[model samples]
Target: MKINLRKSLICINQQKLIAIFLVFMFLGFTLAKPEFASSYSINNILCTMALYGIASLGMTLVILTGGTDLSAGSVMALSGVIGAGLLGKAFSAANPVSLPFAATVLIALIFSGLIGYLNGIVITKLKIAPFVATLAMMSIARGLVYVVADSVVQGVSGSPITFMNDGYSLLGQGKIGAVPVQFIVYVILFLIVFVFLKYTRTGRSIYTVGGNIDTAKLAGIKTNKIIVLTYTVSSILVGISGLILVGRLSSASTVAAKGYELDFITAVALGGTSVAGGRGSVIGTLLGTAFLAVLNNGLDIVNVKSFYQYLIKGLILVFAVCADLFMNKRVKKS
Candidate 1:
């Protein structure tokens, strides 16, 4: 009981510190660029957070199990392309074909889930390291994007597929009074995941597996299934993000969401989630997502060069990983 209490306190303290830092960062940005304080800029920041938060939530789950999915970015692109194709935007102008929004989403989820399942099988059955397995999947998915694009587009094998339905696009761009639809989707996903992780048996199993797979198996937890489920779930979330992204951009391309896996890792780690696994929260991930979004928006407002922004973000990621490792070591000692 005492140990659990101590851990809880530590978690709260870390979250508080992150919150304080976020407030200070926001204020500094607003002061530096007064325009940033405007409602428009604030909305944009929230939108950015939502875009990244959706994927990071899934990443938090996979990472919690001591596994990582480097193919999330590629999966996002693949799902987007497939979803666009199913939406019938790629059909002939004279013979336009379109499916319901629900169908499009379902198709994308299933396709993405299949890819995620493949990642799981490779890791579990073949005994491949998570990093190497996911890296291979990343390449496979990226390469397949051209094949999907070719089937959708007539001339170019890698051309972008445009989504023409305004209603479909509304999922990404619509606002309910003042709240953006995309952010609403993020909040909904966050709440569902938060409850799942905090209040469900399977969620506990995920933590158990990440903390120690052998121990989990000894306890009859079916660790393999848990791992596969986590990867599949992560991919489904990525697929959802892909749809939202396509709606937002009104187009899907093979290059969409390129290099986002690194950003997802950075967000999960920044949220105080140990890279070694077994400790983290949905709320913390959300805060971390906001931090990254705000930092990028603020940097842009301050006219920071793109190259400098990349350097700063990369340094921040390194610091986050180091911090997580240090914290994990301390917890073990305690």
Candidate 2:
């Protein structure tokens, strides 16, 4: 009875500790800068988080299945530019065609999903390690962005430049009452992914495949399908992120959102998700994102230089992975 009571106490304490950490972060920032907690600031950071969070959702899926995607940032740029092109005539300062906004969004999402599908084909059919495959895809994607842009498409308002700023701005910036649209989109996305992972057989198979593909196959799981799906999902989410990024910047640059794959992976790993796969959570990813958002927003509020942000961001990723590995070992021992 004493042993049982002690174990229960330990578990409860652990839960409380995690909760406290999250609360501290929110409150810490709120106190540090009162404006930090304001609706506008909160919404702005959340809006950005939601976009990256979408990409991270796909990345989290891929990582859980024990794979990596280095091309995500590049894919985002490629697909974002495509979405911009689709809105070619929207940039006119004089007048613009509204062209059903929903249609524009759907088109961008499908373009992103299609890119993911191609990634799936390469990894599953070519039998290449995800790292190598995604790396090659990254280069190819980046090159495509340049080729497509050709130094600038010049279509939106006579230049394919201001698509996000002028065209589908609603997706990222438009507000529903007091709340930004991104918050609603992210909440819906989060619920869907959380339910899928918790309740679906195929979702369970992702863990199995990642944990041990050979064993998963012996147990009748289609490992290749799972792997393909993983990359495809990552592609689609990253694509969504690209669209948001383009919107936020109000323009798609071949240089837009370059080098963000590491940021997504870091956010996942920091959320206490495993770098090795077969283990992770949506909650964890969300927490990781919040942490990053707070850090970035805080730094900006305090007037930190953008260059410092780059360095600090890298350190944070490294530390998060280290923390994950350390925590995993502790859990195993317990």
Candidate 3:
């Protein structure tokens, strides 16, 4: 009983530490820029968090399964361009097809899921490393984005596809009272995932697979299936993010969401998810996403240079990774 109680306390303390760090970060930023604590700025941070938080949730699942999806950014761009092109508006491109918003979104998500399925198949059936398989898919997906854009977009080969649809725009711009719709959606997703990971059999299998694939196989868990499922879910979530991004900007560029995978991975890592896999929670991810959102917004509010921001973010990622490795080593020693 004492051991169990101690374990619970440790878990609580870990979460508390993250919360305390966030408080300090908020206070520090507000001190640097008084306007940082304004309602508008706070709302802006939540909106940004929602946009990236959805994708980061997916990344959390993938990392928990001992895998990574380098193709996420490309998938986001591809999904956005595909969905926007289907809208068939006479903005930047003159698409001929005007499907219903729901249909367009479904088709784009299906395509992204297919890409993820392929990535999973390559990693599992072909016995390729997750990194190599996803790296290839990243290139392939980005190429497809360019191909899709060139085929639909009217102007230059690399032009952005722009459109305006009220129904579609609501996903990004709609607000209830003072809260952004996207942020609400993000919270809903976080709750659903948190419950799923904590309560579902398949979710439990994912952790087992990540913890030890050989042991999982011995225990009759279909490791490959879990990996594939994670990849598929990750891609679908990224597709949703892509659609939201397109709605937010009213444009789909070939370069949309470039390098976003790094941000997603960073958030997951900062949330204390193991890079080697098996242990983490959606709650931590939510806090990590909020931290990033606040950090970026605060830096912008303070008029920090882009280069410094990049450097600072990079250092934070490095520290998080090192801390993770250190903890893992200590656990093994114990």
In model 2, pairs of residues that clash are: 154-159, 155-159, 155-160, 156-159, 156-160, 165-250
lDDT of each: 0.85, 0.75, 0.87
| Candidate 3, 196-239: lDDT as tens digits | 88899998998998899999999999999989988998899889
User: How far in Å is the alpha carbon of 143 misplaced in model 1?
Assistant: 1.8
**lDDT by residue (tens digit), candidate 1, 264-327:** 9888878878778888887889988998998999999989999999898888667655655676
Q: Which lDDT tens digits does candidate 2 get at residues 126-191?
A: 888888888888898888787656534544322445653444577767788887777678878888
TM-score attained by model 1: 0.91
Give me the overall lDDT of model 2. 0.75
Q: Cα-based RMSD of the predictions, in order? A: 2.8, 3.8, 2.4
- Scanning candidate 1 in windows of ten residues, the lowest lDDT window is 89-98
TM-score for each model: 0.91, 0.86, 0.93
Runs in model 2 with CA error above 4 Å? 1-19, 90-103, 151-160, 164-167, 307-311, 318-334
Clashing pairs in 1: none
Best by TM-score: 3
TM-score ranking, best first: 3, 1, 2
